[model samples]
Target: MPAIADRTDVYLERFNDALARFADEPTWLLERRKRAMERFLQLGVPSLKHEEYKYTDLSALADGQLLFATQLAGAEAALPSYAAGSSSDRATGAGPQVLGRIPRGARVQSLAEALRSQPDLVQRHLATIADCEDHALSAVNTAFFSDAVVITAERGAVLDEPIQLVFGDGPTGRLPRVLIVAGRNSAVQVVETYAGSGTYWRDAVTEIYAGQNARVDHYRAQVESLDAYHTGRLQASQERDSYVGSFSISFGAAVARNDIGTRLNGSGCECSLDGLYAVRGDQSVDHHTSIDHAMPHCNSHQLYKGVLDDRAKGVFNGKIFVRPDAQKTDAVQSNKNLLLSDESEVNTKPQLEIDANDVRCTHGATIGQLDSEAAFYLQSRGIGAGRARNLLTYAFAADALERIKFAPLREHFEALLLNRFASQES
Candidate 1:
């Protein structure tokens, strides 16, 4: 891998050349890609100095010394001998409803496949959401995006299952761009997961369109090899009376960064975001989120929790912006961190920017160690210290798990989390 001293423009040129290789693509979209490529050249990797990225530094990842999966691995071979403890099973939920939001009529279009079937739609929304505007890496994705999942839920439709995007670890450096569109008055859930035993740098970007009166549940889970690096952006928008519930649970990757934002453009809209990150060993995870309230009578809530140990580090930066016309907006943001070891560290901040006078918004953050008293109480009940700590941490994360509207899926998630606790303790 070339050192950071190499000009970023070199990578930009490579990306441009790759884009030129796609001739069948639309001209407008190609121009858009070129523009983003220019932007990427101007802005390479983000550091802690960026306002939204002040807590996370992605330079080491930009250097790209890490390995990447070049092809999807064997399916049966990826299966675990037993459930729960195995890497593959841990990345999946019990039963079929694990990602219970894709409706029967909705189509699943993978970019690799979309090129032959739904080329227009793919070009329309591919780089549209996280566009190449903010970060240079996003431009890299826009310039050279290949595989993506495209889903469309008709208006007034209610899906009973979550759309699942299973990424077979190809060779390292895999960037998957996924797009989802929910019609007006429709309700759906979509879950994007990263699993497999491959050591790869995973780059993902998702844009979800929640039409007027539509409701959506979005979940992004990362449970991959410890040698991997993950970074992604989730951008969503709401129409009049639309609703969105988004949760991101990350338990993998040596270095992972998540940047997600939702914009409420409709009156009477409700949006909620919940995130849970568990890091151990020398891993570092950072999550940054923003809820933009642009209309009146909108309500938004964000809650994030992190558990770190063994020199692991976690960072959370949540911001809620209520526009001037967004009076009557109700927004709340909170971030809680648990440090299991003296060497573990966490940086958390909850920010609220309110321009409306008649709005009710609050933000708070907390970072602390385990409750010694609670551990002792469990020990007094005959439970071992390790088990007691695991139980407490499980309880701490239970609320977030409970937010899942489906019962079977929720139970599966709980089991997954509990299994992690048990393994860490053991």
Candidate 2:
């Protein structure tokens, strides 16, 4: 455990700086930031004693010892479509890269730009969907966030391509926010990519809103510096008959934590949350997810898997809450982990709180090493022992990969996963 720093003054400075930068921002947003700053001060950074953050420590991060505490450069230049087989620009220190193309008519704008052009749209949804009081990280992000990406689909519009938002950390830390809204009957996909060149702490928040009967697919890839500290929160609200799917891939960062929450505010909403993480070499990854079934007949499915090696650590805590009125709800949650090294550790917990007697809910968790029998069977086929082990490890993670509906994105992640396994073998 590291010593805790008094960040009250630090956050006060940050809040003042943000206010100065956004002096022209709407009064509502400014007031929100003021309130959020107060909340941040009151809550402070969560210590290991904090139940929600018990697994991943943030002392170094809170003190800005691990991060440079640098200021945001400016509005990020639009990233080019990522090219296949190319390393991320942040990883390679190369020029910008592009992957999948966004569909025509879909709107993707930086929050700064949105404020200028679509202030009403940004004002209506921004900071309105997420719970600021539940998490200190959320409050901090809300108070200090300076830049963000916003994407939207008009009512009844169908987007063929997914929108991608890429971010790279600088010498100092960065607080990036994302807002995505899908109008009634609209369909769209959003991909968020996080990477960096140097050690820094990144606190990010992404909020998604799905209108009645809308469909939204969300994905995130975290490949920051190996020495970086990353904490993020993702929240979503779905309307009647709406659908949302979230996919998360985490492979980098010395200390990484993700808090995901979804609220089924309307009946008949459906959601799927899936994640895969590969951590090695003393790194740590933590994921906490909550699905709130607030209305009747809402359905949710969640699965999170991880592979840890070389003294690495992983944590998963998943919770589902079914309100009294959420009758006939159907929910399933699972967390599975594979330990490749005896020294590695993983803590997994799955929880369900149901108030409706007629609702159906199931939760389960499993933690173990790679199957020795399966490895031996493969080795007997003339494959090298190391190769056999790697194959099985890849297969274990492939389940979540296969669930990705986007072919190009799936391939990209597969390549990264294979590269990760190969590196571990060496």
Candidate 3:
């Protein structure tokens, strides 16, 4: 963790290394990488002075304590093993499985593999959704990503099982990317899991494209180590009458920030964004989201909740935009926080910008402590105060948890939440 006085050289070296290693890639991809690198260098690291980053600062990241591995060794054995099947599989040594719970009809490939195999498809939609020119972190990922997970569903295909992607990293840090493409009228569910130990950084980005009338259920569960630093961005582009539901659940990292953006590009499209975050100790978690209605007759809904204990801090900022051409748009946004300790704190801001008079838009935020009356009611029913408090907290989180459609994934998160509550009580 040597502090480099000139961080620009370190980043430039990494960018150059990536270009050299991937020199055989398509010309279009190489040009894209060059553009991303130029934008990243120009944008640099965002400080608290930036309005979008006013609540979170990247001074520590810019100080060069993070290491980016130039050469990867023993990569196969370092892969992550998932908890497939039932909760019983969570036991030690369950063996590593690829494409866990993936249906037979669905296609999955690694970025390197996809570039060599499905170059046309990869080139068509690699950097379409993410706004790399305006976002520095996304630009950095676009320039330095070593590999990615690519999943695609063909036209009219329906997957019966959920697709799971488990990612792990060593101390050198990792930059992983993902692209999900669903064809016309297809439907599928995806679960992305992030877990690691020790002090490292995980910078991840995901781009999703939904064809006409397609449906996608996307979920991200982040459980990084308490000493780690994580920042991620998810961008989605949806077509006519398509539907996309995203669930972002976080319970890890000393400093974690997530940026989610979705554009309803066609008429009759629908998007739903839901998130739940529980943090304790000195952990800090921030979530910023934007939903854009670019066409007429589109709908979007967003709900995010946080439960903070000990000295943890949380931030939630959500915005919805309806363009002038996007008449008959309906959008809603809400952020709620519950504080279990006087030392804990939260900052929430919800905004709506509507350019169309025919649109229906609303946004609001709420931050408060537990209800004493409810606690008293549970105490009168012969329940201990501690147990009653746990019940109330779980109930608050359930509003967002129950939105998960996958049974196994939902059950797994429920168990983790229960264990977290138990630990906090003890």
Question: Of the pair 1 and 3, which is ahead by TM-score?
Answer: 3
Model 1, position 85, has a per-residue lDDT of: 27
Q: Least accurate stretch of 10 residues (summed lDDT) in model 1?
A: 89-98
Per-residue lDDT of model 2, residues 1-426, tens digit only:
223336556767656766888787789898878888787777778889888888899877665444335443433422223422344232112212334444655666666677887799888888877768768788888877766667778898898777665666432236778889899999988877777755567888899999999999998878767877889888999999999999988888899999988999999999999999999999999999999999999999998999999999999999999999999999999889999899999999887888999988998888888899998998888876767777887788888998888777787767665655554352
Better of 1 and 2 by lDDT: 2
lDDT of 1: 0.73
Model 3 ranges off by over 4 Å = 1-5, 69-99, 170-173, 423-426
lDDT of model 2, residue 159: 82
Comparing candidate 1 with candidate 3, which one achieves the higher lDDT?
3
RMSD of 2: 4.2
Candidate 2 runs further than 4 Å off: 1-5, 65-100, 170-173, 419-426
lDDT of 1 by residue, 56-89 (tens): 6666655444422134343322322112222322
Q: What is the C-alpha RMSD of each candidate to the true structure, in Å?
A: 4.7, 4.2, 4.3
Which 10-residue window of candidate 3 scores lowest in summed lDDT? 88-97
